[model samples]
Target: MKAIQYRKFGGPEVLEYVGLPDPEPRAGEVLIETTAIGVNFPDVRERMGVYNRAETQVGGVTLPQVGGLQVVGRVLNAGTEAHDHLVGRKVMALMSKGAYAQRAVARADMLVELEDDTDDVVMASVPCQGVTAFLALQVCTVLRPGESVLVHGAAGGVGNLAVQIAKVLGAATVIGTASSDTRRAFVLSRGADHAIAYDSPHWPESVLSITNGKGVDVILETVGGDVFDENFACLGMLGRCVVIGSTRGPGKPLAPRQLMAKAQTLTGVYLPSFFQRPDLIQRGLRFLKDGIGQGLIRPRVAATLPLSRAADAHAMLERREAQGVIVLDPRY
Candidate 1:
């Protein structure tokens, strides 16, 4: 089997494509012949040793590690007969790591069976980012119907989906924030009712204006630092803000008392934690699958690269060159 590995922490250059023994499925697991592998920002952060502080192995610092969280593939073999019915079935599997390979082993229950005609690349874009977006709005903070939402990094993989998911969840108005006009336009195209430039100091004023000065009912804060701080300005009474990521870096410490005035709520969402709760995982997957089937949610695949060009994939993500998800074709 061929896989991408990084023996040291650094840049995209650290990713190496090399041959390795084919992985075998263990109990409660299945072997998948990968068609498309999803490349996420966490994979880049994992490669840089940013997650090294964690005690658990979330794409570990262990040398020669394979870094990835999701893939779309076909089941080649099941470890046990209890799951034999899945053989030869197409699936989108989410795992903690080892997805950047030709053949990967994933927990049997973690795989979502897909329709035969489902596009592998498009499906590959869903498992990680899609689930995160769904969980952020649906579970992390229950978004009430007819409420308004503000999504930061609206052109990003998770951000793009958050915009659509917010609408699907019955948001009366979905406002998206992006760095450039082009990205803001893209966000508007994804069903956001409004798009504003996050880089602008007056962005909160734009949000307030769009909401008719009432402010938004929900906020998805992915870009931390100043953006996170500015979110409070437009957060409405009893608003719920979910922290999904801090791509720009962590923000200044907050005073818990700030929430006292508006009765606002703050929550954090980490996708990996949901893996332990199969019930929640199934709920999220069902929502995404149904939404896509009904033409309510669309998966955006920005580009696809071959396994050999994994480094280029990482570089594209690091530079934010892709507007949507980037997938790796291991068969290449």
Candidate 2:
């Protein structure tokens, strides 16, 4: 088997494509021949060792790690008879590690079977970013029907999907904030009612104007730093703001009293924590699958490179060069 791994944390240059012995599954797990692997921002952060310094119990990857969260593949075998039924079936799986390879093992219960016609590269982009977007809206904050939503980093992998998923989940008006005209346009194409440039200092005013001064009812905030602070300027009474990620790094501290003024709520979402609740994980996967199946949500694949170019994929993500998700085709 061939895999990309990092023996030491650093830049994309640290990722090495090398040969390895085939991985075998343990009880309740299945071996999968990966067709496509999803490249995410966290993979970049992992390579840089950002998670290692985090004070929270989130996202620390060990040295010499394969460092990927999801893959779309076909089952090759199973460890136990209980999971034998999965053999030879196509699946989209979420894992804690080891997905950046030609083959990987995933918990049998963590996979969702897919049809032969399903696009592997696109589905490969779903498990991490798609589920985060879904949970930010549907679980973290419980976006109500007819409510307005403001999504930061609206052109990003998770952000783009969040824009579409908000509409599918019944948002009356979905407002997206991106850094450029091209990205803002892309956000609108994904079903956002309005697209504003978060790069502008007055962007919060634009959000207020869009809502006729009432402000949006929900906010999905991924870009941290000043953008996170600015979200409060347009958060409506009783609105919910769910922090999904901090791509720009953590924002300044907030006073709890600030939320008291509008009776608003603030929440944070870490996808790994939800893994403990298989029921919720399955629910999120089903929602994403159904949304795609019904044509309500579309997961975009910006580019597909051979697995050997995994370092290039990481570089693309680090530069924020991909408007949508990039995938790695291990078969190449």
Candidate 3:
């Protein structure tokens, strides 16, 4: 099997296209012949040795690692005790690692069957970003119809999905922030009521104007750093802000007095913890599937690359040159 592996963490230059032995399914796992793999921001972080998570000894301090989190593939083998019914099904799975390969072993419990109508590109985009957006909208905040919402980084993978989810969840108005006019147009096309350039000097005021000075009821914040301060300033009284990612790196000052005065709520959400509540994950999956089936939410895939060019894919994402989801075709 061909795979992209990084022996040491640094930059995209560290990624190497090489051959690897085929992986086998364990007792509670299934072996998937990968069709597409989703490239994400975390993959870059992990490759740069900046991913802040507990480390496990694999090969050594500089262990060779496969990069990827979500994969759309066909099930070649299923575990005896877990997912025998999944044999020969087209599905998507969330892997801990090693998805940037021709084959991957994933826990059967984590796999979701793709509808026959679902395209391979859509299947590839759904697992990580789809689940994150669904869970964030359905569980992280108390969403109400007729309430205004704002989405930061609204042109990116999870951001684009979040925009559509907010609309489907009955938000009265949806505002999204992007950095360029092209991205702003793309965000509005995806159902955002308003798209503002976060890079603009008047962005905070623009959000305020859209709400008629009332501020937004819910905020889905993807970019951290200075954007956090702006989000806080744009929040409505008693507003809820959910922080899903810190793509801009974390360093921010908060106004505690302002928060107290407005009776605001600030919450940080990590999707992995949502899995601890299986019902939430199940509900999210159902919502995503239903939305896709009904055309209430659309999966936007900006580009597809051959698996061997996984390094270039990462570079594209890190450079913010790609929009929506970028997928890798392992069969290529």
Candidate 4:
């Protein structure tokens, strides 16, 4: 089997496509023949040694790692203790590591059966971004029907999905922030009531205008730095803001008194924490499946690269040139 591995993290050039022994399932695990591998922003962050997570650390050192989290493939075999229900099934799963390869092992509990018509590319894309969006709406924030919501970085993988989920969850209006006219148009087409460019100095004012000065009831914030600073001013009284990622920059000062004044809630979400809660994953999968079935939520594959070109995929993601999800075809 061939896999992309990096002994020391630095940049895309650190990634090396090399041959590796086939993975075998251990007790209570299943082996999957990888078909599609999802390329996420975290993958790039992990490679650069900047992603914050416990799994990103090992033996007090985080180097020498294989970076990939989500995969869509067919079950090739199962361990003795694995449930008999999974053999030879088409499934998608979140792997602890080692998904950018021809074969990988995963805990049976993390695997979800895929419908025959479900695209492998979309399945690979959904586990991380879709689950994040779904959990943000359903768990982190208590959103009410007829309330407005705002999504930052709305043209990207998670942001795009967040906009649609906000709509499906009964948000009266969804405003998405993008960087360009093209991305703004893309966001509007996908369900955002209005799409504004984050680069504009008056973006927050635009968001307020869209909500008729009441401001948004919820905010899905993926971009931090100045964008976060601006959006914080536009959150309604008692509003909830969920911070999932900070793609822009890390350091930003906040006025705690302002949050207290409005009784706003600022929360952060990490997918691994939710992994321990299978019920959340199940609910998210149900929503994703139903949305796809009903033509309400569509996961876009921005680009597909062969497994050997994993380096190029990382390069695209790092440069922010890729929109939606970028998939790796292991068969290639």
Give the residue spans of candidate 4 off by over 4 A: 52-63
Estimate the overall C-alpha local distance difference test score of candidate 4: 0.84
Rank by TM-score (best first): 2, 1, 4, 3
lDDT of 4 at 223: 84
Question: Model 2, 41-144: lDDT tens per residue?
Answer: 88887789988986745667778898898999999999999989999999999988899999999988777899999988878988898888888988888887
Each model's TM-score, in the order given? 0.95, 0.96, 0.91, 0.92
Residues 65-124 of candidate 4 have per-residue lDDT tens digits of 667888988888888744667888888888667788889888787778888777888778
In candidate 4, the residue pairs with backbone N, CA or C atoms under 3 Å apart (3 or more residues apart, or in different chains) clash, namely none
Candidate with more favorable, higher TM-score: 2 or 4: 2
Model 1 Cα lDDT, one tens digit per residue, 209-262: 998999999999999999899999999999999999887888799999999999
The superposed Cα distance between candidate 3 and the true structure at residue 47, in angstroms, equals 1.1
**Strongest candidate by TM-score:** 2
Residue 243 alpha-carbon offset, candidate 1, angstroms: 0.4
Q: Per-residue lDDT tens digits of candidate 3, residues 1-332?
A: 99999998888999999999988788878999988898888788778876544552122224688878888888898767468788889887886788999999887767778875678777677777888887777777768888998999898888899899888989999999988899899999999999998878678889899999999999988878878777877899999999988668665666677679889998867866765565666567667777887999998887999998888999998888887778999977
Q: Model 3 off-target regions past 4 Å?
A: 52-62, 255-257
